[model samples]
Target chain A: MSSHDHHHDHNHDHEHPRLSELQLRVKALESLLVDKGLVDPAALDVFIDTYETKVGPRNGAQVVAKAWADPKFKAALLADASAAIKSFGFEGRQGEHMVVLENTPKVHNMVVCTLCSCYPWPVLGLPPVWYKSAPYRARAVNDPRGVLADFGTELPGDIEIKVWDSTAELRYLVLPMRPAGTDHLSEDELADLITRNSMIGTEIVTFPAKAQEAAE
Target chain B: MNGAHDMGGMHGFGPVLQEKDEPWFHGEWEKKAFALTLACGGLGQWNIDISRHARENQPPAQYLDNSYYEQWLHGLEVLLVEAGLVTEDELKTGKANGKSNVAALPADRVFKALQQGSPYAREIAEAPAFKPGDKVRVKSMNPPGHTRAPQYVRGHVGEIVMHHGAHVFADASARGEHGVAHHIYNVAFTAEELWGADGQGGAVHLDLWEPYLERAR
Candidate 1:
């Protein structure tokens, strides 16, 4: 090893080589909380598991698929998203005030939180890493077309892009236009095709055949 | 406050790093941070608005440098200290120095707490200042405190889309006060209004509290 590299190692002999500064801080905080009898480490696992599996993008996908299958339910969802979403047992916290945005042929909708990471946790679970990233936050508002392009969602020039800035209390859920030739599909089958990105307006839900075509 | 968190219309943030098949949490620390914040938040000592202010009131450099959960951890620490639940020395030593005035959220109640999430909306006595379809201009005042108004939306005119019932004003709630209740509206601003003539062809809808707006002629 070079002499400078050896000296660099010597400069930080007190610090733990494996853990970063932030990681060490987190460990310290956890240790203190556990030591003080303030937190149960076991509960932490439960919290993570709940959001990770029990409630997630699948919940949102079901809401979208159900809306696609039932016109009356779609009307209710369009009229009052907060009430309709609660009917599915997805309510509270970030989703107390929900607004469903429908994307038609003439208008496309996209969602972004510019102020902070205000998302519909109950319906869509926790947001993706990119949804909360700095680049997406700034660019989503300034260049909606560019942000859509990054996701490989290229729309016709005449269709207007309606970007929803989730700046305040309300969280948006984008209902993408149903794919063609899927009229025979049931709600469960359609839910399987729905992705987290499609409900967020970054992409459109496609049939299994189209997905395969894109893959090829 | 016009903090780095108000990053609408700003530039130079670079491309978003998209991860394929990403997990819910990056590591153990993030999971702990999330649980601790929610658990402590269940204490009901301070509201969500106060917690948000704690994260936003950081120095620009520190705020930008922090990851999502790091920001949460940072804010949780400040709130814990400010609420007198834990001392700085206790935080540093990783041990309790003395008897704590606060109580921890019991493990059994974690699921109940998660299921019964805190709702921000509250009943208010006053009528909203504006109604739907009315044109209103966002007040252009920048305070050095917590505010929901983004820097880019200030002083711009937009049409009201819907009226959300009266709720707690965030600025007052951030300071641990009983903020006066007011109506919130979904203000629809055209991209051209917010970003000027060169702005893109689109519309940005925002849910703004009554205080942040004034009727436009």
Candidate 2:
């Protein structure tokens, strides 16, 4: 049978040897801890549950939202991104020397870690699967606009899109243009405007009203 | 061995795995591990001994079971704990205290400041090593580890279009052992020049590094 046929047949099924092995190891490790009385299985379960719900890109979204609302703050962000970002109390590994690129009418910005998926995790959280995917890493540098199109982002033909590849030395975070109709909104409301996908340049942030209208 | 980023032409094996759709805590430990590795390198305490051994002798199946990030985290933990930068107890305490101990700057503020052209003033002020009209060729070297020079671009000649100031080197093999300041360059190449007339684009631009180029004859 052809590969395409095989793929269609298994459309709903997926196999991950690595994940299975990991699950097995996790169980084994948990049992070991329980047997040694070092930790309780229930406690471990609680910890895992809390971590899953509480830890994520929401903090990054808040930072992106604040930048969208304040111009001087945006200026500070552009001038010394690392220090400015620190003012909000977010900092770290991939974030050591963070640089923020603004997407404007004249020019747009997209970031990629062409070498081994170097991303600003502390702010952006874990990169989307596509960010680390081989197709993205390879095509983004060569055909940025085309790739953006695939992601449902199509810039005006006149506008220029500058693709920035993050390296070990400096990391990048994209500041997407704030959607219109978001004025008069509170900081928390604005923070709600930001999405992790927007920060990564995959999707544009939409105002809730506009989004709701569209959905309707 | 191949560079870490060179995964092109290897797609047909299986379906794409969407990491977001997976359970939230699935890769939490793994992400911590990956950050620790980067932190160790940032703090100047990276040791490749274990990595080299792992790559050479190959660890047990259990070791391979964890995601790449998990392995990286374990490696970082081993190195940092051994070096006394962090103790296991401290790590646990920090975890209990809520959030990993790594420091971070706010994302939005950083973006705003950089847009105002105030952050990289000193670095930007320094004149570019090469100008827009200068002709340069990508350097030819088969160094181990990750490099910005895509295999297709090696030995190809291009012209400097713009000069982005000094940036960090992407080659982990070089920077992992010794600190080096690598600069980024915007080099433009005609499609015909790199891939002949059949190449789709009229001209291709590459943001290459200084070491990736030499003066074109």
Candidate 3:
């Protein structure tokens, strides 16, 4: 070992060199809370399990697909989102007050929580790291086109972009426009095309060439 | 409060880095942090607004430097200490000083509680001050406490596009006053209005409460 490297090992002999610093901190906090009866370890597991298994972007895909397949459902979703979403048993937490913004040929809708990472958990699930990151939060409202460029999303100049800053308790979901060539697909097949980003309004749903060929 | 968490228009953070097929929790610690925060929240010592304030009220340098879960952990620590559920020494030592009298959230109830998340909307007798399509101006005032109003929208004029019923006022709720409701509206501002000549060709909508706006004359 280099002499400089050896010099920095003076007090490191007893400490855990394997676990990262953050892991150690978390371990310490969890044990402390559990010991004092402030939190149950099982409850923690439930939280993790719930998000990992029961909830996610797939739920949002189902909603989007249903909207695309049924005009009545689409009207219901745009009119009273909370009730419509509740019908699918996706009601709670970050989704109490729901507003589904429909993307059309003229207007594109994007969602962001500039103040904090407020997201619609019931539908879209926990926010992706980029959504919570500072760059997305700071620029999504001001330089949205620039931000979209980062995601490789280029929109036509004539189409107006609408950025929704989730500054209150109300949560928003972007109902992306169904791709033109997707009419031949079933609701399940349509749901397969909906990505979390599309629901967040960062990307537009595009009919994959392979899928179009299969349809043909 | 005008903290770093209220970043809307200020720049130089760089392009967003998105993970390809990212997992729900990036690490083992993140899961714990998320769970601990939510579990403690069920203890009823503090409200969601207060917990948010705890995160946003941190030192600007540290607040911006920490990762998403790290920020949540820091806020959880602050809330625990202030709520008298845990102590600084206990955190450092990784040992509990004594068993807290507060009841821990039962594991079985976690699902139901999560499914029935706290609803902030409340019914108020008075009608909203403005309606859809009504022009309004965001009042310029800086309060040194928790506020949902982003700094970029302050002093700018916008038009109301939707009216959300009265909801619990976050500013007051952060100060421990519960049930205070205010009418909130989705105010739409042109990109040019918010950013001047440098603005992009688009619009920004903010869910602003009644107190933050006034009729545009």
Question: By summed lDDT, which 10 consecutive residues of candidate 1 chain A come out lowest?
Answer: A1-10
**C-alpha TM-score for every candidate:** 0.92, 0.63, 0.93
Tens-digit lDDT track for model 2 on B83-194?
Answer: 5555576444333223324432222333332223212112434455677778888777776544556665677888886566775444543335334445667776654566
DockQ-based CAPRI category assigned to the predicted complex of candidate 2:
incorrect
Write one digit per residue (lDDT tens) for candidate 3, span B81-125.
999899889988998988999999999999999889999889999
**Chain B, candidate 3: TM-score:** 0.97
Model 2 vs. true fold: TM: 0.63
Question: Where does candidate 2 chain A have its weakest 10-residue lDDT segment?
Answer: A1-10
For residue A16, give model 2's deviation from the true position in Å: 1.5
> Which lDDT tens digits does candidate 3 get at residues A1-216?
001111111232232233388798889999999999989999999999999888888888899899999999999999999999999999998999999999998999999999899999999889988899899999999999888877777888889999999999999999999888788999888888788888998877777622321110
Tens-digit lDDT track for model 2 on A156-187? 66666565655334667778787788888887
lDDT of 1 at B172: 80
User: Could you tell me how far off, in angstroms, the CA of residue A137 lies in candidate 1 after the best superposition?
Assistant: 1.0
lDDT by candidate, in order shown: 0.81, 0.54, 0.88
Comparing 1 with 2 on lDDT, the higher-scoring candidate is 1
Name the best candidate (by lDDT). 3
List runs of model 2 lying over 4 Å from the truth. A1-15, A24-56, A209-216, B1-4, B8-22, B27-128, B131-135, B156-176, B179-209
